[model samples]
Target: MTEPVPPRLLLVECPGLEAPDEDDGGLHLRRFGRVVEALSSVCPWVDAVRPGVCTLPIKGPTRYFGTEEAVLVRVAEAVGEALGPFREGGRDGEGDVGSGDFRLGVAEGVFAAVLAARAGAVVPAGETARFLAPWPVAVLSDPELVEVLVRLGLSTLGGFAQVPAADVLARFGTRGIRAHRLARGLDGELSGYRVSGMGARLVAALGHALALQDLQPGFWGGTSAADERAGEVLTALQRRLGTEAVTVPVLEGGRGPADRCRLVTWSPVVARSSPASSPGSSSAPGRERKGSRRKASQAPLEPPWPGRLPPPAPARVTVGERPVEVLDRSGVPVGVTARGLLTAEPERLSVDGGLWVPVVAWSAPWPVEERWWSTARRRAARLQVLTADGVARLLVTERRRWRVEATYD
Candidate 1:
């Protein structure tokens, strides 16, 4: 047997990309190019094949940069610097970029490399088989040829490689033959990233608490070891940004304390709940309830985008053009409460006074009347009002009284 040619692959995964928001696709690719440019600085010979994707001929970098491990460390650092601003708000308290959910995979070949990236497997050379054998055939669904192999029961890459190439083509056609060749490490093919980086990008920061911790099967707390790792990453990000006031903007529409803020022109808004109605069980009980409430809001409504329209809760952080301090010696917000954004009047409320201020805002009667027959809770009215501070949500109680629940600051 003769020696097989060496294969070196690098796979990068960038998460948090939303589907395109417009037609041009140029802006998307441009942003991706920026990231590629940053990566190019560390490894100059890298090929910027697409906006979000790039590859370095690993042999050159490994040789020039001293070692494969050293090259990867440089790549990781450069990527974090370039992409860190994007993941500004993370659930884990660590504020590192590419630290949120992005991953990288290094392997001996392109197929194995991409699989490793998806699986979060960073395989060293001479170990592709250990990494590739366990992955199911589903990942090969792309390239059309792999799907044929899967349908023929050659589900694993290892399995595909073992089959005779001539027999594979005879049974499954030309595509299968091509797939077998690639699977068996017989070919080297690279697809130019023609689409570019086409998507919307939002930066979010995982809270410091989230970064230093992992879920313990059924519990929530930071492991001491993980906490040290988080501290190192946080310190690195701080050193890069050159600021002690680095606070990530809270993501809007989050389930708790943070949400997006928009500068929409203020208007009196009407609120309505999706009338309780399940699909297909119609015309008798459920249909009657929905029909009864059509008169409440005349606007035609679509089914609730699952959980998108959950009752808005008052978010607790301060949001402004400048960063707000999040902690003090006691680990408490020295400046304000969670609701301070909704009530604190910078112009009127004196700093020396108590945190609470009396502001008149509308509150919807709690237990707003709903379909009486079904189990769904309904209310007669939903409160919509604005304050000098911002917007607020009030909940009516079972006793028919109202209290401020949440505010949009």
Candidate 2:
């Protein structure tokens, strides 16, 4: 078997950089992109896993610069130059340039590089296992695996790595085996250990091409604080319950109140854009057409439905097992005649057997017939009434029974 490739990874991190509040715009990504661009000048083979954390293959850069330490110093200088002047008290306002300590780590694999970067140290070639031995298993970011290891009295990477690989695989599956490997300084699938020197050269060439393409300037935009907070809360709630726990109210195309609206899975990105842009509008950059409103309205329209309800839709509507009662003066139930009229005008109403409310005013009943050709045909007459307490309700009568269909706030 061929010997494992010696790790040649370089991890670069910007210390004291906080994730920007979504409201602060894309400032975080922009700054991170700038850093990536700067580091590309030193080593074109760069991968930005997140805003502040980045990795690079150091073999080619080290050969070019004559030493691994020289490459690290060059990367630090590039990051500082890209970040510009240092601002005291951290990043303050929009458009203000700030600088932070740039930590560089060089080791055999990605995981070892990350650990070294955090400690501001460099692990020499082939010494990754010794360097990572004393670190905690929590660095793997797998809470369950860490907990299991701690319970087994294996808290440090060295202790956990002592376990048999087959046993770890049997106990924890693929993820557990991966953690075990990382603890042993074997960074698993994505690390340089899996790639030969020839493969690294090819990957470096492809990365360089991609970096050049990404150097093009891009526009940035801000996000709403309310939308950001709402997304965070929804994400947390989904994590506790299942993803199906959170839903959003969406308006659909229909005449009936119930048919016009629906509940859908919540999406933060979609929700953020929905409130600001209109349907069919050009949301893409530089694609907006001027005077599109007139063009849209002037387009051929569908034949109008004569039975459509007039303006002033109800603000609230409740539909479920609970029923409301509408009664006449004699305490008898109010019924709708075959001619789509109330037999005895509504005199009182009660919701869910609550206190009776006297009707102050009412409008003429409007009939709505649905599924006329089917056995499940439904016929209802709706009446808008004002109660003595000044509440407006839309009451419907179907099969000689009355129910509160909706209400105006």
Candidate 3:
């Protein structure tokens, strides 16, 4: 368990605001709301783990902003600005609100990630156990267990981690086992740290209508408490997990399913705003993006990865890596030409070195290509084939190698 590598995540902590009191008149919650809103601009999946702590998957931002260190800089700046608005009123109520009010860190798991944020340090990859070893057992957040462990000379997580897993389970039961996992960096989060339904509570604390409140579920052509609640739950889960952990399919213009379909973070606001652009046969398993027609006389002869495939959509889209062999009646291999035409008719096919099956019918190969002069240009083709066994399958070829692209039931 010492090497139980943690997930890469980014955490934001607001120390002064974690324990908001009645005397603060709900200002802390409102300010925290602004923090979440600002962070949403940086990442749609900002999880409000609790009142003053939150986390987001660090991978996307790291790749986008260049590095984990860069992500922390960017997040700290955004959170600072969010808390900036309340700064002028610092003397009135908000206490010294400034960029220093927030801290950001990057780590692999939620528990380690949270401590990293509080300390404003990045827990280097594979170093979570090292980073946590010296911390007191109290950070585990089990006060009663903390006392017992401390009394037993397990004052620090490192010592506590030395306790064998079996002993922890046999002596201290489930709670001790949980704490031991945290010590050894085997668990990223515990049960009680994240508040249930935090999204709903945040909305209630804001005490104001949301930007898209009236049309929250309008994209589905109707609205209901059920839908709104569901959206809230999704938002909560996003806060608990990272945004990349949740996604929704979006249809866009392309010749094939892989190019036309994408997975995006599910947001009711986005759902309501985006249009239903793709049109496909009722039989297709998924919604597809439709390519627009050219108005000018001299556009490229072939449409740019545009247009729907003729009629009855595929019942299934494939992972598309399954290799295949296609041959003509003469047993010569078939191929697509520089002119985008087949060199020979496909008379039979075999999948993954299995027995050959005669091809009873196949549509004309549809050419796929890049611009004529691009150095790294791509050239491929897709064809529909009906085999002797009566299975309707879609096949594609590039550079003479063939593979399954989809299947029709």
Candidate 4:
């Protein structure tokens, strides 16, 4: 059996930092997500560490595209298309936003890829050590370690790497050992374990034998060791506590507070790419066709609905079985009147078994009437209120009852 190929990694850096305001930060994060989604179209093994930095394992793509340079060119073009019209002043005359300078780097490992990105260089396979040799020890980002290296006259990465590995470990501990390994281009040695093809075959045979013996295999084909271990753990827990014991969060898109997200079974395959499928392949089930093209043509992921609540969205939203009470000055429960107006001004609000909180400020009520022509039709008006304790809440009134929809921290 042939040995597994060494990973070729690509690092992509976005142009800017997050803005100070919450809304601005959300916008930046959304834009960053778009970039990663776009890159996923080219290579599914993309990992976005933040809005500004992401890495992709490009070994498969480099082969599929014919050459490493070809893959790089394709990625650059894809990014440029996805981030349309980002000019110097942030927007063009037609109001199209443009992304600023983007840097791409390719190397044998993540650390090397990051350094290559900083210098806008691509280090070829088996040459990572040579490329990193002349770089300064300060690149490690540990000021204390750099000072020690400087005092020892080891200013370059090569000099630092030349120190005995055992001595480095003895002096600076694990962190220093890791830095020394990277400086010596031993990233793979430090981070990954190499299992021979014979060993993998033996493990697979053992799994099959266990399955035949009426025992669960707890392993799947073509998955990483980490994924197999997680599956085993989940299987053991479920066997002891039943299937419903384990669940994972799933983010759903919607306009309502309660409809936005939910929980489902923890399936490892949910995020894993299929080994038999290629990126942008139409043959893959449930895979989008022309997704990349559509993404390139559309505006960024800005808010789709107008007149919605602004950012710093609610941290907690509770839906109660019974309605809460809102009262006016005369101690009367405030209800919606005939003309869609409140029977009396809302001065204070209280939930069952909870203390009344005075309303400090409020905005005009916005009415929503859904499925008006059907038997399930419902009408409600939503009010945004700030309580005396400086908490922002969304309240909705249906029929004669008031309920708190969400609370913003």
TM per prediction:
0.41, 0.44, 0.49, 0.43
Q: Which candidate number has the best TM-score?
A: 3
**Per-residue accuracy of model 4 over 1-409 as CA lDDT, tens digit each:** 1323236578887655222135553555555554554565566666654445667777777877788888798778766654544533533523423245578887767677777888998888777878889999987778888899899999999999889999999999998998798788776332422222322232242231111112232322224434554676776676778877787655454334654555566555743533333212322243232222322334245332222334556787765653578888888987764444566788988866489889888755545544444999777766677879888887878887888888775
Question: How does model 3 fare in lDDT?
Answer: 0.73
Kindly provide the TM-score of model 3 when superposed on the true structure, using C-alpha atoms. Answer: 0.49
Pull out the clashing pairs in model 4.
Answer: 85-98, 86-97, 86-98
- For model 4, the stretches where C-alpha displacement exceeds 4 angstroms are 1-6, 17-25, 88-99, 188-409
lDDT of 1 by residue, 1-409 (tens): 1336337767555553222235745444344444544455445444443334555556766776798778778778767766666556656425533333456777766666666677776677667765666666555555566666667787787787778778878886876665555565544433332344222221112212221112232221224424443454555575677645343332233211232332322111200222323332232322233322332343235332211223454553333322112122344332222211112221222112334322345322212233455787443222334444554533222223223334454
In model 2, the Cα lDDT at residue 98 comes to: 36
Q: What is the C-alpha local distance difference test score of candidate 1?
A: 0.45
Ranking by lDDT: 3, 2, 4, 1
Clashes of each: 34, 1, 2, 3
Worst 10 residues of 2 by lDDT: 216-225
Decreasing TM-score order of the candidates:
3, 2, 4, 1
1-409 per-residue lDDT for model 2 (tens digits): 1337446688877754434345745555455556666677776567665446677888877888898778888888778765655433445533353335567887877778878888888888778888989998888787877898999999999999899999999999998887788888776323333223322332242232224224322211112323444676687687788778787776654435665666777777656555532222331334222222322443325222223344578898767633668888999888766655577877998987999999999866666665545899787767788999999987777777667778888
Estimate the lDDT of model 2: 0.66
Between candidates 2 and 4, name the one with more favorable TM-score: 2
Candidate 1 deviant stretches above 4 angstroms: 1-6, 17-27, 90-101, 142-151, 189-409
